[model samples]
Target: MIEIVDAVAWLVDLEVETVRTDAVQSFVKQETVFVEVTTNDGNKGIGYSYTIGTGGTSVLAMLREHLLPRLIGADAALVERVWFDLFASTRATTVGAITSLALAAVDTALWDLRCTRAGEPLWRLAGGFRPKVPLYDTEGGWLHLSTDELVAGARASQAAGWPGVKLKVGKPRLDEDVERLTAVRDAVGAGMDIMVDANQSMTQAEARRRAAAFEPLGLSWFEEPLPADDVAGHEALARGTAIPIAVGESMYSVAQFREYLARGAASIVQVDAARVGGITPWLKVAHTAEAFNVHVCPHFLMELHVSLVAAVPNGRYVEHIPQLRAITHGQMRIEDGHAVAPDTPGIGIDWDFDAIDDRRVA
Candidate 1:
């Protein structure tokens, strides 16, 4: 048995490369919390989780004080058992962001160890349904971009052979949103898929109204139209509109995803590995969505999500929002229009520790 011998956690703040804006929030710096686990046999694995701007320190504290300690001397091979034990130990904080984020750090590290020891890439070890998934560019779709800019970005993505581009919605007036989407549709023609995200800034009534207005544009999906907890609202909205309701980026547990699926609220699941407590529950959410016949297009963490989307049969497009280029040694590879999963062993991310050490804030 490979016994866990040591664990360490730290914080790194990566500044956003561009001004990322949506209806509700602006892109702030990424507060990345990384955890490294070393086994008694001298093998090491690394995992990480992050917050948009806040709570990184809290996640780090949770790992340093509560989660990491529990990993010591535990069997590294039993990743799922370790996950459950940690969840049980942190029962009081179960199903919340801080605990979930903290748990993700440890859980992903264990997965890294498992994949490395097995001599398999994470995508193959996790599921191996495919080695590549289609990509959609979100970097040029910020809500702040003008219609001309949006059109230009969409045209650029089309020129690059990308299948889709996501645009941000939630303007003060519904006509403005329609006008922007109309221009992109007209510019990109009918071949390129167009998606829109409201970032959970709309009321059910507003969402319904916009969904009705945007339906004629032939959008791929409407993401985070309303807040995440409003299952009933989402259900009503889904029934009232032809556009697919995409959610799960804000959710923190598999139970939450199950609730959304059971109620038929969400059609596309955008489950974030970090937000859902790492690869363990992330897979559970994907399989759950699959059981419901829903497709998953995860939010952010393209570096990790590329492998995961490649791992599952029901996986769909991966949103392209590059935030890790400043700290990671390599970037996610895109071929033709799809993001390719890393063929390397472990989590597939080549961490540039020197850059991480330079960015360390806590």
Candidate 2:
């Protein structure tokens, strides 16, 4: 039996490389909580989860005070069982951000152990549907960028052969958002896809208005126009607009996704593995979205998400937001505008432990 002998958790803070602004908030530092698990036989796996800025200490506390202790002596290979047991143990706090984030760190670590034991990379072990997914650039489309900058960024992505670029919407005025997106659309022309995200900053009425305005621009999707919990609002907006309503990054559970898909509230599902409580449930959400014929374009964590997106049939596009460069050895390889899944055994991120130690706060 590959029993978990030890589990350790810590915190690392990664600074944003550039100023990332969207409709609701500025890009604050990433507060990452990493979990490392070791089996009795000496095999080990690493897993992690993150918050945009706050909640790192809480996630770490949850793991150290509750989750990691339960992991000791548990069968590391039984990934699903471990996930369920841990979730059940934390029933008081189950299905929320802090608990889910803590659970994610532990769950992903177990998956890493499972993949290592199987001697296959996570993409193949998870499903291995495809080794590459087409890329979409989000790094260039911050709401703070001027119209000229947005145009230049979109043009740069187009020149590089990337199929899509996402722009941040929800400006003070409807025309301001329109003006920026119009410039990018004209700059990138008809070949490259243009996606817009409102970051869940607008009300139902405002979203409806923007959807109508953005329809003529030929947008690929309008993401998170309303809060994630506003299912009724999303359903109405989705029904009314021709542009797809993309959502799910802010959601914390599989049930949330089910509600969205069952009601036809969302067209593109942006399941963040970390936010969804790691790969175990993340896969469930993706498969559920598939049943509804919704394509998943997962939000953030590109390194971990690349393998996951490549593993499923209905995986659409991987959002390109580079957040791991400072504490990781290398970047996710982009070949011909598609993000390639790493073939390395276990979760494929090459962590720089030295860098992590330097940045460790807890």
Candidate 3:
């Protein structure tokens, strides 16, 4: 057993260039909490979690006060055991954001350490289903953009050889959403896949109405039309439309994912690693989706998701959002329309500590 020696964490705030607005909220900035763990055997691994703007300090506090201390003398290779310990430790806040984010930092670090020790990339270590996965662009489609801007963005994505482009929905009138989607579809034609996201802004009845309206457009999927916790609502929405329902970035537990999958609520799973505890449980959730014959198309963190999506057979697409380029040393490789996984021995994130240090807030 490789005994753990010490753990450390810090916060870095990354500012966005554009106003990223959706139906529910706007992304003002990214408050990322980074973690590093060292083993007595002279090995170290890095991990991180993210917030859109607030609550990052709370996650860091959870790590410092509750999670980090427990790792001082434990076996670093026992990632799953340590994860379970952390989950049980936070029984009061089980399956919530702060607890899951804190646990993600520790759990991901252990997986990175394990992969480093074995000298294998995370994709190969996980399953090695494919080295590359298809790409879809979400950066071009914000709710604030006009119909002309949406059309231009979709054309650019299509010209760039990306097979899919996602648009933000949830305007005051359903006709407005339909008009924008229709224009983009007419511009890009039938070959290009157009997905739409509501960002959890609508109720079940509203979502069902929009789903019925959107079915004629031949959209690839309708994302987060209803709240993330509304599994029964999602099941009803799924039954109402021919369009597939994609969800899971907001879900925090494997049991929640199981609930979504077992009831046939979601056709595509958008599980985020940081939100689901870390790589350990993320893989479990991916396999569960595979059992249901659903595709695992994770939300954001494309740098890390490249390897993870490529790791499993059921993995489908990686949402393209460039939030980490300023702090990371290298970019995830993109060839034609698919994203290539990083060959780095650990989790494949190459952080620029100088950049992070300059941006560190707490």
Superposed Cα deviation of residue 49, candidate 1 (Å): 0.5
For all candidates, what are the clash counts? 0, 0, 0
lDDT of each: 0.94, 0.94, 0.92
Q: In candidate 3, what are the lDDT values of residues 139-248, reduced to their tens digit?
A: 88999999999999999998889999999999999999999999999999999999999999999888888888888899999999999988999998898889999999
- In candidate 2, stretches whose alpha carbon ends up further than 4 angstroms from where it belongs are none
Q: Clashes in model 2: which pairs?
A: none
Better of 1 and 3 by lDDT: 1
Candidate 2: tens digits of C-alpha lDDT, residues 244-340: 9999899999999999999999999999999989999999999999999999999999999999999999999999999999999999999999999
* TM agreement with the true structure for every prediction: 0.99, 0.99, 0.99
Q: Write out the backbone clash pairs for model 3.
A: none
Top lDDT hit:
1
- lDDT for model 2, please: 0.94
**By descending lDDT, how would the candidates be arranged?**
1, 2, 3
Error of 3 at 199 (Å): 1.0
Candidate 2, after superposition: displacement of residue 265 in Å?
0.1
- Residue 80's lDDT in candidate 2: 91
